[model samples]
Target: MTDTRRGSIQRLDNIAVVVDDFEAAKAFFGELGLELEGEATVAGDSVDRLIGLTGVRSDIAMMRTPDGHARLELTKYHSPSPLAGDPQAPPNVLGAHRVMFAVKDIDDIVERLRPHGAELLGEVVQHENSYRLCYLRGPAGILVALAEQLG
Candidate 1:
């Protein structure tokens, strides 16, 4: 049998995070070092149908790392409202709960993000011959892991 494959996958465009405060979420990611790429409002039946929500309207902010290869989309739904979740949910709870980023200096980054209300979920720990990693609870209780490579 011959191998049959459709269009090849290009690259990951962005990760979407639904938040209650669009501007605050944008600022959180920005303080964490992601540059604001752009922001816009999305509506219409097509969007609603696509997201499986009726009368859905949202404001979205696109954030990108300095390298420009990675992106994060922060969205705030204005119609049909949004729901609240356990912000402090444990890691084992499942679903897409966290995003990890490689950083040059985890400690420094953590310090800088403190004023923005970024709290370390636990102490930063060094993994044997791999990395120094720590989980941070950022705006809206978004969990972000920071990894600094070891020499």
Candidate 2:
């Protein structure tokens, strides 16, 4: 092996998730603890340069973390077909997955989401590392995960 050293890695920057309704997804994530940072529009030119798209109108919502380091970017395209099959299923076939957030009160957060039409995909289970997590589907099948860090 080469005797070379690299600089230390820093904290996570951000992750992006595609949504059906920008406003609804923003509200859903806000209820889970993240705060809406702002929104942006990506014109067709930008989209084409990014992914060979002729035109694209997307609404982007930037959610800030409490610590102000990592962020969750939610993007909703104005024109796109709905996801097929069971939307609740993991997007393994499509190469996408849900983002899991660690929280202090997972149960309480899940309770708060009940009234807003959020549904749990599985029962919350306690793990060995003093953790508990539950899968949830938000508005428009937006996959979400709520986890409590007891350790």
Candidate 3:
């Protein structure tokens, strides 16, 4: 880690996802309106080399949201391994995680994604904090959330 000055952190840059097929993952996310930013390889000695006795030299894809701030990075390990999927339980399960996006028209967005093959996980609920939210499983079991904060 670099020893930088105080208040060095300005903002969030990106999020990453490891995918088996780069083109397919990009296509899936592209349908949701995120644009492809670029692609690259994790080339360096300092990175991990062995995963369950398999070598690790992988290619990756980087994508960005429409606003051009947050990012989605997809990486695929060349070696075979157990497939990745949603945790065998609800979001309350330990270590379970999902990405949340604040949207203006949650209902409209939900409707729009139906034709693109998104599965509605649950009905939108009004929370105690004046928030309306819902869960949807998008391409490749990706858990996406839409939230409208009334607070």
| Winning candidate number (TM-score) | 1
Q: How would the candidate models be sorted by TM-score, starting from the highest?
A: 1, 2, 3
Per-model C-alpha lDDT, please? Answer: 0.88, 0.77, 0.72
Alpha carbon RMSD to native, model 1: 2.4
The sequence of per-residue lDDT tens digits that candidate 1 reaches over residues 62-125 is: 9999999999999898997888888878777868489999999989999988987889988999
Q: Over the full model, what C-alpha lDDT does candidate 3 score relative to the true structure? A: 0.72
RMSD of each: 2.4, 3.5, 4.3
**Clashing residue pairs in candidate 2 (N, C-alpha, C atoms within 3 angstroms):** none
Ranking by lDDT: 1, 2, 3
Q: For model 1, where is the 10-residue window of minimal lDDT? A: 1-10
lDDT of 3 by residue, 74-150 (tens): 77766445367663346676666677777777888888788766777889998997899999876556678889888
Cα lDDT for residue 31, candidate 1: 80
For lDDT, candidate 2 versus 3, the one ahead is 2
